[model samples]
Target: MDTIIKFRFLGDGDCPDWLLAEINTLSRMTSIKIKILGQTVVKYLTEGDLDEEKVRKITQDAKVELNDAKAMVAALELIFTSSARYAVSAADLSSELQQLGLPREHSAAIARLHTDHCPQITATLSSQSLRVSRLSSIEVLSCDNSSPFSTVSLKLKRLDGNVENSVINISKKDVHVLLTELRRAKSLMETL
Candidate 1:
């Protein structure tokens, strides 16, 4: 038992219902016991007797996990809605969060994470076996316009959180094929 760190969340708007449920479950676990501080406050202690350095390290680790969870939830909410097929920009998502009544600091943190880390995430998700029903959206990544044969890479995140980074080996014939597919898609939609 180390006195590393104790974390408590007042079950208010600061803590979401889902997180409260997670906290409740954590309260029941054997090794790490969560203490109910009051009617609306739930607290968990890491260990009973950790030194100061260990306490700092453990607290930092916990903060990292919390930040990751927050980023994922915020990203999913913005990028994976029922009626849309594309992931919006972080700035756009931040504005949305503000509209939803989240504090600016909270929304800005998520926005910064989305802009900074989401490109890698999008690339990873696009490479997976994601089954999206609607037309795909591309996160503009990079283009090699300087080369004799230019190539472009796009990152995509599917509705189900799968990521992919696809590169197009573009040439004249490839351009024609792409145009043909676009025309076919337009025709099919017109028929419907």
Candidate 2:
């Protein structure tokens, strides 16, 4: 017999009793209101803040507590961000939310929004990632008989919009290994 594991859209501690109760009110809200909430969640993902007016409108329409509305907003952010990070499909996200006690209609609406804005969400997150400069160019200098190493020059573009040059010397065997790894990386990238 095979056991199936379901994907969780939110963390274990993410969904509280209050949030679960809040989600039950989703059925009372109009589809347009639900869509607005979903869009607000996506906007927050990209901009890092929720529209207070929209939140107030949603809270008024849903007849739920203001804190509950805020919690719902926070939950939506967590769900979509986790989904985007894990590359979860929209259908799967809906199913996961449903399993978490979200109303089917609201879950579907949120999932559709996830599908529509996933690319932008992913791009925004990747742009915010911490990393070193990106390699812009590479140059190999001629090896002379006086040395048993090759000199390589690399040009990197920093995140701060500055270009930095780097030079390194490598042994012949290391150069061969580096070339092999670089070729392998190119091959893998082409497959993608």
Candidate 3:
């Protein structure tokens, strides 16, 4: 049996309790296996070989811009590790992928995650706030487009599961500082 990696899935609303229970039951029966990968994440691997040829065809048809399969895997690894909530928002994921400077079409392939793809990936993005200690949502309120330097007003919902959000109206300079501090804080947290 081939091994499949269960990156990390925190206890989340992505899957309903009943469904999760059923998966657990099946796992216990040895029909499948659930491997806990970390304190807050679990990897679900199944015994089998994936249809790489099919994946290739899909990748080609989708015109994915990743330089190679490893690049795609690396991107996914960063994205999966970037947060503790066991999920990454499409918008946030886009920032990481867009750094590659792929064309819109190719980028779209990477950013194709929508509410339709999986409920876990999107959460209750329409109304839920996640209540988890990570980025739950982001809403762009306004962007001033005057010159090379532009200001943006953003409403970032860091809370999870339908709670009131934190709104910030900030300039580009402030965004840089905030991002720096955020990265530093993230680094500190990872050390723990």
Model 2 misplacement above 4 A:
1-22, 25-28, 131-192
Compared to the true structure, candidate 1 yields what TM-score? Answer: 0.29
What lDDT is obtained when candidate 1 is compared to the true structure? 0.41
Instruction: Answer with 1 or 2, whichever has the higher lDDT.
Output: 2
Per-model CA lDDT versus the true structure? 0.41, 0.72, 0.38
Local accuracy of candidate 1 as per-residue lDDT tens digits, 1-192: 844321121211233445434333322322111111110110011121223343334334444344433333333333322102245666665565554444465546545645555544445445443533333444647767675565767675554567788888786446556657756764554443
RMSD of 2: 5.4
Deviation in Å, model 3, residue 184 alpha carbon: 37
Ranking by TM-score: 2, 1, 3
Q: Estimate each model's TM-score.
A: 0.29, 0.61, 0.26
Residue pairs with clashing backbones, model 2: none
| Predicted structure 2, TM vs. truth | 0.61
lDDT of 2 at 188: 54
- Model 3 CA lDDT for position 50: 36
